[model samples]
Target: MDGRLIYLMGPSGSGKDSLIQAAREPLQALGCEVVRRVITRSAESVGEDAEGVSPAEFELRREEGGFSLSWRANGLAYGIPVEIDQWLRKGRHVLVNGSRGHLPVALERYPELVPVLLTVKDEVLRERLLRRGRESPEEIEARIRRNGLFVGDGSIGDRLIHRLDNSDDLAVTVNNLLSLLKLSVKPDQI
Candidate 1:
């Protein structure tokens, strides 16, 4: 199969959803497919293109081998549907908004997978998280703390990772992402 999997991972409030949306057209022009994840969190709770399922339901799905890959974080379970395997095997470039903690498993499963790690300044992260209003102040602080070690916990290294800073304008970040994927920017899209 000629398809490649791009695993996009980042901290909370790092503009992941926005980046994914913005990159869709350009990436697709280059024959890439971006997929929404199956998150345990309700769709109404966030802007991500995700389907929400109860924890129990998620567990059932996991046990029944419904997910090609799955991971849990911050008390929420996340999964990539098994349908993606077919897409990849069919030589469709597939991108998934993924979890950093599950990178090892993902890498093991797809050796050709590229891990795109998104990051932003600490202050910017704090400000964005606060603006998002999805968590309490204490919860935000806890999230920030967790994000601190996201880059250097030692599970993965920088060698194979393509890191991007999302602190500035999103257009700039999206352009960088396109370039990273070696996708030509369509003039009309610029």
Candidate 2:
């Protein structure tokens, strides 16, 4: 990342969603745009983006140039709305929680993406999955394995990275992100 993308990444159950929501104000006040993705999964499930669409609808939108980029993860399809590129082209910092496996390709679009690798202890992740109460114990374990915690191929993540251990403390993690982005700790925004 060249230093402008503000890419948020981590394994499943790593508090990525919460951290992204928490960073909204600081990001916007700093002139950063948050990308709303289109997901194939049901909005009711965990890890589904709030702005979700049916698989068929997502395909239609994609065919009509609604997405800047799209990828599949664990059988689910995800699309980054085309608006994100427009905002980034305007030189606005864009904060996005993208597909972990697609980080390198995403970075190629913008030379200035600041990649942040959010991490947590394995046990903490397991506990969080349990607390969410959507997955059985076996499913949680499988998710942990699927997430492949902290195991990068050393190609993408080895580059410029701001690693945050988000184990049990979200406030600190968000604060650190704000500091890293040179954004105000508190922001007055909608």
Candidate 3:
């Protein structure tokens, strides 16, 4: 049996990095491999645990087909190394921080992937973005707007896209994700 790809996506400030960090141990215990993305940003950046590389290096790697999945968002490039294919072939469940706009392509490549949408209340999202201090007020507002549009756009449809609400506590969201994972994958695999 091939492994399932859990593609977790959400707007900025939806606490993806925090959730992944907190759930890492539990996810590993359940045989899920949380992939570390390759991003075109500085390692010193205070964000997700991505491997940062220069733009030139990123382009070189992409051109050389080192990445199985790649996309550009928020003015930066992100890549998922081709090693994920090997992990999946070995029946090891994999989780990736993915882009909503790139979901169609992902589904095209991995038809059986489990698409997960992490969502937060607009007020909560706005507050978190402000606390992170990574974007200007205008930029934050724009993100919130985009998030609203995405949520209400009917794009997810009934395509087996699971939704996790990260509105109140991180622990709750983590538990919910674990439960969803258990339900999504085969029992023996877990």
| Tens digits of lDDT, candidate 2, 1-190 | 2125677878778898899888888878887877777788777684644676788999999999998778888777888888877676666777888766788787777656677788888789899999888778998899788666556543454575667789967889988888877742123321
Worst 10 residues of 2 by lDDT: 181-190
Q: On TM-score, who's better, 1 or 2?
A: 1
State each candidate's clash count.
Answer: 0, 4, 0
Please list the residue runs of candidate 2 whose C-alpha ends up more than 4 Å from where it truly belongs after superposition: 1-3, 47-49, 146-158, 183-190
- TM-scores for all candidates: the values are 0.89, 0.84, 0.95
Residue 96 lDDT, candidate 2, scale 0-100: 83
- Candidate 3's C-alpha runs over 4 A off are 153-158
Question: Between candidates 1 and 2, which one is better according to lDDT?
Answer: 1
Q: Identify the superior model by TM-score, candidate 2 or candidate 3.
A: 3
Task: Report lDDT (CA) for all predictions.
Answer: 0.84, 0.75, 0.91
- Number of the candidate with higher TM-score, 1 or 3: 3
Which 10 residues in a row give candidate 3 its minimum summed lDDT?
149-158
lDDT assessment of candidate 2: 0.75
